[model samples]
Target: MVRIACLILALILPALVAADVADVYDFSDRAQEQRYRNLIAELRCPKCQNQNIADSNAPISKDMRDVVYRMMNDGASNEEIVESLVGRFGEFVRYKPEFDSRTFLLWATPAIAVFGGLLVVAGVVIRSRRSGSESPALSAEEKARVDKMLADQDRPS
Candidate 1:
């Protein structure tokens, strides 16, 4: 029993000792550290859609963190650093991609769809109104036929 317990402990000990090395970010200054954390939080982890690179545990997240840190240490401004990364990875890396020609539809598509739906609804309303106006003056023969049908129904029980 003691030997079995010892084996179990040994097995578990190695697993516990193997730490996740990607969480550590070495920044020389508090400001740079804050900037690095902020940028990483704003940037999406390509491997994990729901998490920012700062909070992700994936290797790709670590690599992205390293890239941001390197750019910061090189004295790049926050905007410049973000631009550099965006340039390398494209708009998909950003939590909010910029609105440009290719992505114009992204921001405007919903509004355009709403406008189109309104136009369709207006067209249907206008068409219905036009049809109602044109048919208001039913032919005398049609009115006589409708009156005979009503008279027959009225004469029944």
Candidate 2:
């Protein structure tokens, strides 16, 4: 009986918690509503590390959601809201970082490394081909020994 009651509580607890957080804000326009949803999904939760603001249940996430709501209601452009949050929290608040001097290495490092690796592989292949095609001539004694071996093999052995 105790185990069954505990299981029921565990199952129902999340639904009750979710109901308390469903504070839906009405938008004056559908476009604004869409914009708000997009912005929340794009912004990262500073406290939650990898989670977006919309998916985090942390208190800081709630505060950020409220800020997004207020900013949208005030007719702020998407860029303005993003810039404001970025200014307050640094670039870490954005899921997709901009291609700037600070982040150039982050975006271009893999491509540069792959290109360098290809150049090394091509160099090695070219050297191997060149060496194989232009092999050193064998000494006359060595040639004679190889010929004798070939003759021996050819004889009905």
Candidate 3:
């Protein structure tokens, strides 16, 4: 039946696609495999900001995975692998960015904004307190008019 064929196709497609994964690289040891996993998890997929290379099915992510595997197999250090990728892809490749002069603003922006907001609020509060303590003096004519109005209001209806 067409329905049976469609269901079978749906089930088999994922396995066929998963067959294309970066598992082609053979690790000599469990530690090497774990390091490869960690590197892939830490690297972001260029096409998808929220997904790491390990979880992304994007072509770029697959390529990144391949590169990481190859680098690890060649006995490259983690920092060396990361730095090389960072050179090619920019610092956005890492989920946790390294701190440097260029990245200091990225890390500190939120705190700076909060501090600026608090300063603004303090200014407003200071203004309110200053304004509340005294009112502007009325002119003599206006004072006389207000006194007359009060006197009229106080009289028996």
Candidate 1 lDDT, 1-157, residue by residue in tens: 9999999999999988896554666778898778777899899877887798888888987888888888788888888978887888778788888888989999998999999999999999999999888856779999999999999999958
| Residues 39-59 of candidate 2: C-alpha lDDT, one tens digit per residue | 999999998879999999888
Global lDDT of model 3: 0.90
State in Å the error of residue 31, model 3. 2.9
TM values, all candidates: 0.72, 0.81, 0.70
Q: In model 2, which regions exceed 4 Å deviation?
A: 1-19, 154-157
Cα error of candidate 3 at position 55, Å: 0.8
- Measured by TM-score, the strongest candidate is 2
Residue 96 in candidate 2, Cα distance off native in Å: 1.0
Q: Assess candidate 2 and give its TM-score to the true structure.
A: 0.81
Provide the lDDT at 47 for model 2.
Answer: 89
How far is 88's C-alpha from truth in model 2 (Å)?
0.8
Scored against the true structure, residue 9 in model 1 reaches a CA lDDT of 100
